[model samples]
Target: MRVQALIFDVFGTCVDWRRSVAREVAKVLPQVDALAFATAWRAEYDPAMARIRGGERGYVALDDLHRENLQRVAAEFSVSAPERLAHAWERLDPWPDVVAGLTALKARHVIAPCSNGSIALMTRLAKHAALPWDCILGAEIAQDYKPKPQVYLASCAALRLATDQVMMVAAHNDDLFAARYAGLKTAFVARPTEHGPHQTTDLGPESDWDVIASDFHDLATQLTP
Candidate 1:
């Protein structure tokens, strides 16, 4: 496919955001259902970004959106939201295969995150998860969010690669759809439990993606030279 770079959807595809955030939520809001709380907070994510994507608001970093959502969820749960809790997004843990898989991919092609996360958030999360990233590219670079053509195209531009020369690796069919529409290659990595044990969405590939793998380890074997 002439792929020179692999851009990833970081939150669920690389890291287990639901569990990682729930762990932190449990520590801070012990009285509430942490998993439920984490899920609730995350549920606010797309709607919040939609404001910007739809031009109802100017662009802001994902950190700000996270903080805003945390406040609302905390109030809904009748707990005082700790200011520091906003930083929890920066402390996500990667899936078990992520580190080794990304390391292998890095050996051959450039690897970076094409996430909705701001560069600062992505950088800190990379450090926390020990992800081997070649660079950070995504919403911050395009001043927009994912599912938007600009976000995917800008990420490829940042790497100085043509759309076809880059592959967007994501677990979500919608994400891959957007990336493909932007002219980049697509890879679907099944993260069946990204939303936890009973996760219903993105359990498998929904299209004829360029590559499909069971996990990052499998993805590395398929994509890495």
Candidate 2:
């Protein structure tokens, strides 16, 4: 089936969150290990969302989760000014190939983010990173997070497309696994440095996804005209 839309996983795949967040952290907590701080903060993301997914907590925007997680991680490191640091997620930088690739891909298909990030967060980050997104979709719209059937189905419904007509692109194997289960075609764009130098997960495509590309630029070559 032809892929009419490509819904991206933004945080790590479209943007270099680790390095960018670490850099931002360095500015605020000059004494802390910026890279480790960034890693620690991200480590809490899934667990935070899991609470909501499991019905232990209610749905909240990524910003709220990030802010709450920042406070906890900051206390762990005894870092001051956690409030300022929480905004780092908004200022993340895009991967080098992202702009060109998204532009190329957008010419051929509708391109949007199906990330866990909120619409406001995604909008600000997109502006900060100069990302070209057609629309923002995902947790905010679904009132639920990814790896859940509702999130993927909500995105497909919003775009007025069938599940098979859309492709979910991500660097995370787990995310793609769920998307595939939701009946969306999957694309794995390897983001080896997403978690920094020693990252082990998502080093390559973990399963036989519908498409696997080295990066968004390569994805453009394979999926875009």
- Per-model CA lDDT versus the true structure: 0.94, 0.92
Q: Over 4 Å off in model 2, which ranges?
A: none
Q: Write the per-residue lDDT of candidate 1 for residues 111-133, one digit (tens) a residue.
A: 99999999999999999999989
- Stretches off by above 4 angstroms in model 1 are none
| Residue pairs whose backbone atoms clash in candidate 2 | none
Q: Could you estimate the TM-score for every candidate? A: 0.98, 0.97
lDDT of 2 by residue, 146-180 (tens): 88889999999999999999999999999999999
lDDT of 1: 0.94
Tell me how many residue pairs clash in candidate 1: 0
lDDT of 1 at 181: 95
